[model samples]
Target: MADTQRTSERINFVHQDEIWKAHVKVEKDSAEVWPRKWGFLTEAYKEFERDSVKLKEVKVTPSHHLATRPLTPPEKYTNVGPSPPVPQTTQALIGWRSAHSRLQLEQHGQVHHGRRSFLKVLGWPRDACS
Candidate 1:
């Protein structure tokens, strides 16, 4: 009769195409530092709780607060479909087209040194800057 006790440990491997692997293993000790470590963490946590309570008790006026509340446009401008396409958007479109042309020219060993673009907005001269 042969002994059937297996001496080898089972192979533990991650099943994934990823490269990074990590794990932690701590040996048990009769007198462990874990208690002391936990005590220190608990003391720090209590201190943080006290500080948080102090923070909650603090009352600062909005004017004294460091963070500025962003200024959003009034409710009417929130929905954009009502307005027609503005001149700024048209200029932006033209700019994108010119940039594409420039890229193509550069690829073909050509240099474009002229001004990026010129936007001429044709509108009736305002009598008093409308």
Candidate 2:
């Protein structure tokens, strides 16, 4: 008997006849500590799209985070309709303490302070701080 192999096909949700290909150029900066890699150039190719209809491409550099992009109104058409509603989220406050601190507090019924002060308060000999 001969072994059979099955080929897998990509299932794209958008069944549009158009196809898009993106090429990216990445650059790594030399650093004595931590080096960060970022994409410098990005080129997009669209199949079946007219060459005259150029898509707006934004090149994000490593320094992009340092400055904010200036907002410009659309030159061709006016933006209409009400803005989308902001998402509502709930925040929670969480805290943690060391087990050793908890143990000392449980055993001595005391809170945060130096070891010497804590011992001295418990009638134990206090050592030189030096």
Candidate 3:
């Protein structure tokens, strides 16, 4: 009951803030700062990414790239190469089964395999999902 009330209050507060924001006048300074803010954020993200342990510098191999002899994109901007392949439904099912098996290892209850894991993968609580 308390949790429900808190959720409702949080939702109400969010809606109220949205309503106020919609009516509030935009300042020229706020518009001007957007590009500067994004530039700073992009630079910071690049710096952090460079320093991250997971980031590895790769030397490009000569054979790695395809020469654009025939289907070469114009000197100007153009969509290059092939689009990504569509994923099969079984791929998702496999992921769900794996995650559910992991969850089953943690808990006492019997996991309903794909059904329970489908909810887990979709970010739904097991009890609420049912």
> lDDT: which candidate is best?
3
Model 2 is weakest, by summed lDDT over 10 consecutive residues, at 20-29
Candidate 1 lDDT, 1-130, residue by residue in tens: 1223543644334532132322222234423767766668888899999999999999977674777878887775654333334346665766453354433435567676876323324444545343
Query: Against the unseen true structure, what C-alpha lDDT does each candidate score?
Result: 0.55, 0.41, 0.62
What is candidate 2's CA lDDT for residue 76?
A: 43
How do all models score by TM-score? 0.27, 0.10, 0.19
By summed lDDT, which 10 consecutive residues of candidate 3 come out lowest? 78-87
Q: What is candidate 3's lDDT per residue for 7-121, written digit by digit as tens?
A: 5444577777887776664655567788777778888898898777354665555673565456655756753444334447866655453354443345567556554577778
Model 1 residue 16 lDDT score: 24
User: Whole-model lDDT, candidate 2?
Assistant: 0.41
| Range of the 10 consecutive residues with the lowest summed lDDT in candidate 1 | 16-25
What lDDT tens digits, residue by residue, belong to model 2 across residues 45-110?
Answer: 333244435443544466867887887769547534443333354322122222335323365665
A best-first ranking of the candidates according to their TM-score comes to 1, 3, 2
